[model samples]
Target: MNTTPISSRLHIAIFGRRNAGKSSLINALTNQEVALVSDVAGTTTDPVSKAMEILPIGPVVIIDTAGLDDTGELGELRVKKTYEVLNRTDLAILVIDGTIGLSEFEENVLKIIRDKNIPVIGVINKKDLSQYSEEDKRKWEEKLKLELIEVSALKKHGIETLKMMLIKKAPYDDRELSIVGDLIKPGDFVVLVIPIDKAAPKGRLILPQQQTIRDILDNDAMAIVTKEHELKETLQNLGKKPSLVITDSQAFLKVSADTPKDIPLTSFSILFARYKGDLEELVRGVKAIKKLKPGDKVLIAEGCTHHRQSDDIGKVKIPRWIRQIVGGDIQFDWSSGITFPDNLEEYSLIVHCGACMLNRREMMYRISYAKSKNIPIVNYGVLIAYVQGLMPRAIEMFPLAKMIYEEE
Candidate 1:
C-alpha cells in the first residue's frame, strides 16, 4: 500500500485559517503524528503531503496546506501555495473553528472551492471546547449548502464520523479507466518500444511504460518490451504479428520505419493524453503548429522536474524540431512541476508533457484551464506526431480522434 504512486491515489486537501486545528485534524484522521502540531499561528509554512491507505477510503494523499488567512509578505506567498493545491484536490475539508464560526476568510475559501467544482465537507473543529449548537449548524448548512461534520481533532471526538463522511463524499468512481487495455482483446500481443537514452532512468523504465505493461497484463494480453535498437529483431522473431506497436515519442521516427505500416503505431505520451486528458481536444490543438508565426511564443510545460540531458526532448530536441518546422525564430518558454504561469495570454500555443507524474484531475485541470483561456494546448506525443507528419498514422487506432483531426 505504501508503495503506491502519488499520482494513483485520491488527493484530499485540508483548508482553513490559522490555528483552526488543520494540522491537528490531520493527525487525528490518520491516528499518527504525520503532521507537526504547534500553537503558533503559522506553523505549517508550506504544503505537506502524506500518502497513506485509509480504511474505507483505500489509497489517498492527504495534503495539509498553510492557513488561508496568513498575513505578511511571506504569509501571502504561503496562502498562494495553499490555493494552488486545489488544482489536484479530489476532496476538500474546510476546517472552521467552532468558536469563531465561519468568517470572511472561510467564506472566501469556500467560494474558491465551489468555483473549482470540488466536492467538500465543512468541518467545525474544537467541538469539545465550543460545541456548535444545532441552530449554528443549520445556519452554516443553509449558507454553505454543504454537509457539516463537527469534530474535536485534539480529543479525537467524531473522528470516526469524519472518516465516514470522507468515504461518502469522495469524488471517485470504483471502476478505473485503462491506459491501453480496452483498446485490445485478450491474447493479443502489444509491443512497447522504449529508447534507453540519457533521459531514461538508470535501472528501470518510466512510470508510463510500467503502467502500460501492467494494464496489458490485467486485460490478459501479452506485452513485449524492447529497446529501439532491438525492435526490428523482436518483431522478426515473433511467431505472429503483434496487434499494435507503441513507442517512445523520441524514437517515433526510427520505430515507425522499423515496424510494419499495417500495424497501428502510437507513443506512450499519446496513450496518456487520452487516459489523463482529452484526446480530441489535444488532436485539435495540433493544428496550431501549422499556424505558428515567427514571433509567436510557445509554452512547453512538464509535470515533473529533472536534470536535463544533452538530448533532452523538452529542452533541446523539441525546440529544434519546432524551429525546423516553422522555418523562423519563435519564442519559447518552459515550466515544470506544479508551477504554471497565470498569464497565459502571451503564448500562442502550449505543449505539455504526458503527465504520468500528475493525477488525472490535475492533468484535466491544466487542459481545461488552457481551454478557458482560449489557448491551444497539445501534448508532447501529439505535437511530435504532427511535426513528424505522422498524425494520421499515430491516431489510426482511435477512430474518433482521427476523424476529428481530419475534419479540422
Candidate 2:
C-alpha cells in the first residue's frame, strides 16, 4: 500500500556463492549502495529485500540472497533460509563469478530452481577485471542451455538490459478471478451475505467480499451486500430471485436454511479457494476430518491477521467444529499472516483459509510442499461443509469431485 505498490510486482531473486558480486549487482541495478558490498566471504547472512518501480516491469521485489557455499552451522542455516525465498520468487538471477564460471554449488542451486520450474537468467559478474574468455562463456552457454550476460556491478553495466529481460520473463498478471465473473450473467442478481460482527474491520470490507463485488460489476452483473440478520428481509424485498447466494463460511448453516434450496448457494471462502488456490486439493483435504483421531494435530493457516470475532473461525469455531465432528480431542496449531513453517511433516492435516492476499505461486508452493510430504490440506468452506454434514451440497460446484465424493 506504499508508493511502490505490491500489485503485479515481479519477485526477482539473486543467488550465488560468497564474493560472487551478488550484493554489488543489486547495488548497481538500483543505482545506489542498497546492499553492503565487501571482499569478505559470507557478508550477507539473511535475505535482503527491496521494492522498486522498474519501468516496463513496474513494481518488483529484488532479493539479495546469502552465499550458497557458506561454511559451518550458521552458514547452513543461511543457505536453508535462502532456499525458502525461492517459493515466492518469480524470476532468478544466478550471479556467478566470471573467473570461475559455474561451480558445483551454483549448479546445485540451479537444479533446485529448475525442479520448481522457475525461469533463471545467468549473470556472469565482475566483468570489469576478470578476463573470462569468450570460449568459456560459449562452452558454458552450450552446456547449460542458458544465455550468459556479462555485467560489471562495480561499473553499473548491463543493469537496464536485466530489467528489460525481467519484464519480458515475469508473468503479466498474478491473480485468479474465475467464479465471481463466470457464475453471474450480465444484469443478473447475486446476493452476498457479509456478517458485520466483531470480526468485521473498523471501516473496510474484507478482501474476498470486496473483490467479489468488483468482479460482479466487471461482468455487468448486480451484487447486493447485507448482513446475516438482514439477509432474509433483503431476499424478500428483492423484485426478483437472486441467481446465486454467497455467504461467509461461518454463517453457512443459517444462510443455507434461509435461502431456498432451489437457488444455488455457496460461501465466499469456497469461491476464494477455487479462485486463488487448488479447489480439488481442499475438497480432498476435508476427507482428513473424517479420519481425525483423538489427540491428532491440525495446523490452521490463515493468510490475513486474526480478527476479534465472537467465534474466531480459525481459533475457536474450526477447532470446536472438528472436535464435535470427530467426537474426540484434537490439538490445533495456528499460523497467521506472511509466515508458514518450512517443515510441515508433523501435522496430521493442514486446514488453510482462503489465501486471497497471496499470489498463485506462493499458494501452489505451500500446496506442493504439503503434498510432497503426503500431508492433506483443506480450506475454510470445504472443512465447514464436512463439519456441517453438507460436504456433498457445498462441493456441488465442482461436478467431478462431487461425483467422486459421492462414490467414496
Candidate 3:
C-alpha cells in the first residue's frame, strides 16, 4: 500500500487542441491506454493524471488536459480549469496538430505559459500523417519561437526522443529532499527517534524517515533508530554524543527534554521543511500557535493517505495537544492527499505535514496560497515545538534559521 500522493511526483502537462493527439501522446509515452483518445474535440474536459515510471526519468505524473481550441461557454469553463493546472505543472508538452500550424488557442496558451516562465517542449504531433519538408519544420520552429519536435503518438514514434528531451529539459529533480547530509561529518552518529505508536504505518517507515536514513548513509554517517522510550538509554549507551537527534513530531517535547541542548536536536518534519526551502516561513507560522484561542478552528493538513496507527497524529494527537495548550475546545479540520478546502478563510491556523510526497514547487505553492490569504501556515515539527515550548531548541540545529528567528 504505497498510497503516496501523486502530487509528490513530477508533474508533466500535455496541452493541445482536441484531436491533436494529446491523449495519444500520453498513451505512447506511458505505453498504456491511460487516457481515452478520440477524434472528437474536447474529449478530455478535465485533467487526467497518470503516474508511471518513465525511462531515464523514474516516477512522473503525466497530466492530460482539455483541448485549448474548444468553443462554446462550456469550453470556456474547461479552459479556465486547464489554466489552473499551470501553477503546479513542472513541465509542459505543447502538443499541436502537425498539419495545422500553431493556432490562436495554442498561441494564447503559449503566451500564458511563457508569462509564467514554465519550461516547455513544443511537440508537433501527428507527424506520421502530415509529412513536413525540412524547410517547413524549420519554418514552424521559427514561428513558434521554440524548437519543434515531430511526434506520431498513434504510431508510437518519437517517444524515445521525447523522453530524452524531458531528461535534458527538466533533468531529474535530485533536490526533492533537503541537503541535511552536508550538515554532518562522515562517521558522525545521528539518532532518529521513530515513535512506533498508533500513527506508525504497518509495513514500512514513512518517506521522510526513509529518506533521512538514506541521506545519512549516503554521507557516510551512522543513523541510530529508536523509539521515544529508548531515548535516555540510547543516548547513554552510545560511545559519544550523537551529532544530531531527529525525532517524530509527536514526540518532540519528550525527546527535546531528554536530549542535551548542547547536541543539535530537530525533527524529521523540520528537515523536510528545510529540504523544501521554506524553513524560515514555517518557523514564522509557529508564532501563530500562541495566538490561537479556545474554539479556534485549526486545519491539520497531511499530504499522504491515512495511517493505520490508532492515535493518528493528524486526527488524534495534534488536536488533543492543541486543546490542552489552548485550555479549551478547538475545532480541527483534516485534509489529506491532493484535496484542500476551498474556503481557507475559516481556519485560524494551518499545520501541514512534512509534505515528503509533494515536490518543492507544489509545497511553495501551498505556502504561498496560505500567505496570499493572510492565513498562518506551519508544519508538524514547528507546531509541535511551539506546543512543547522548545521552538528555539529545535530550531537551533539550523544556524542561519536561528539567526532569522532571534532577529524576528
Candidate 4:
C-alpha cells in the first residue's frame, strides 16, 4: 500500500481559513505528524500532500492547503495556490473554526466545491473549546445543505465519527475499468511493442506497460512483450494472430507497418487517454491539427517532469512533425506536472501527455478546463496518430472514438 502511486490514490484535500486547525485535523486523521502544526496563522504556505492507507478508505493522498482567507499581497498568492489544488482534489474537507463560526470565506470555498461537483465534508474543529453547540451545527448544516462532522484535533473527540463519515461519503465507483482486459477475452494473446531508447527507464518497463501486462494476466490473457525491432519476428513465430497489438506512440509507424492490417492496433498512450481522459473529446480535438495556420500558438503539456533526452518527444519530435504537416513555423509553449497556465486563451491548441501519472478526475478537470476556454486539446497518442495519418487506426480498438474520428 505504501508503494501505491499518488495518482492512483484517492485525493482528499483540506481547505479552510487561517488557524482553522486544518493541519491539526490532518495530523489526527493520519495519526502522524504528516503536516506541521503551528500556532502561526499561515504556516502552511503551499499544498502539502501525503500518501497513506487510511482504514475503510484504502489508499489516499491527503492534501493540506493554505488558508482560504489569507490576507495581504503574499496571502493572495497563497490563496490562489489553494484554489489551484481544487482542480485535482477528488474529495474536500472544509474545516471551520468552532470559536469563530462560519464566515464568508468558508462559504466562498464551499461554493467553488459545489461548482466543481465533487463531494465535500464539512468539519467543525476545536469541539473541546465549547464555543459551538449542536444548534449551531444544525443551523450551519441547514444553511450549507451539507453534512457536518464535529471533531477536536486537540482532544481527539469525534475523530472516529469523522472517519466513519469519510468512509460513507467518499466517492466510490465500483465500476473499475480495465486497460485492455475488457477488449480481449481470456486466453487471447496480446502483443506489446516497447522501444528501448535513451529515455527508457533502466532495467525496467514504464508504468503503463507494466500495468497493461498485469491487467492482461488478471484477465487470464497472455501478453507478449518485445521491442520495435523484434516485433515482426515475434509476430511471425507466434503462428497465431494476436487479438491486439499495442505499441509506444513514438514507435507507432514501425509497429503499425509490421503488424497485420486485420489485427487491431493501438498505443499505450491511447489506452490511457480512454482510461484517464475523454477519448471521444480528444479524437474530436485532433481535427483541429489540420486547421493549424502559420504563427499559431500551441501549448504542449506533460503530466510528469523528467530530464529531457536529446530527441525528447514533447520538445523535439512533436514540434518537428507539426511543422512538417503545417508547412510553416508555429510558436510552441511547454508545461509539466500541475503548472498549467491560467491564460489558456492564448493558445490555438493544447497537446497533453497520456496522464498515466494523474488520476481520472484530474485529467477530466484539465480537459474540461481547455474546453471551457474553447481551446482544442489532444493527447500525445492521438496527436501522433493524426500527424502520422493513422488517427483512424490508432483508435480502432475504441469503436466509438474511431467512429467519431471517421465522421470528423
* Total clashing pairs for each candidate: 0, 0, 2, 0
What tens-digit string does per-residue lDDT give for candidate 4 at 1-408? 886778788999999999999999988888889898999999999999988777778999999999988999999999998998898988999998998997777888899998999899999998888577788889989988887888899778888898887788789767577888789999899999999988999999888988899999999999999999999999999989999999999899999899989999999999999888999999988889889999999999999998999999999999998888889998999999976789899999999999988888889999999999999999999999888878788887778998988883
Per-model TM values vs. the true structure = 0.96, 0.88, 0.86, 0.97
State residue 312's C-alpha deviation in candidate 3, in Å: 3.5
**Residue pair clashes in candidate 2:** none
Per-residue lDDT over 1-408 for candidate 3, one digit per residue giving the tens place of the 0 to 100 score: 135446456789998888899998999998999999888888998889888876566678889998877789999978877776776788899987987766677777788888877899999898889866779878767877988888899998899999888877874556545446767989899999998865676789988888898889989999999999999999999989999999988888889888987889888888889886489988877777778898789998887776435666678878888888788989988888755666789999999998887777767878888888888888987878777788688888677677766764
lDDT of 4 at 251: 93
Candidate achieving higher lDDT, 1 or 2: 1
Estimate the overall C-alpha local distance difference test score of candidate 3: 0.82
Q: What is the C-alpha lDDT of each candidate?
A: 0.91, 0.82, 0.82, 0.90
Ranking by TM-score: 4, 1, 2, 3
lDDT of 2 by residue, 206-267 (tens): 87788788888989999999888888999999989998899988888888888887778888
lDDT of 4: 0.90
lDDT of 2 at 125: 89
- Any runs in candidate 1 off by more than 4 Å, and if so which? 173-175
**Which of the two candidates, 1 or 4, achieves a greater lDDT against the reference?**
1
Q: Where does model 2 exceed 4 Å of error?
A: 1-9, 27-40, 52-59, 171-179, 304-311, 337-339
TM-score of 4: 0.97
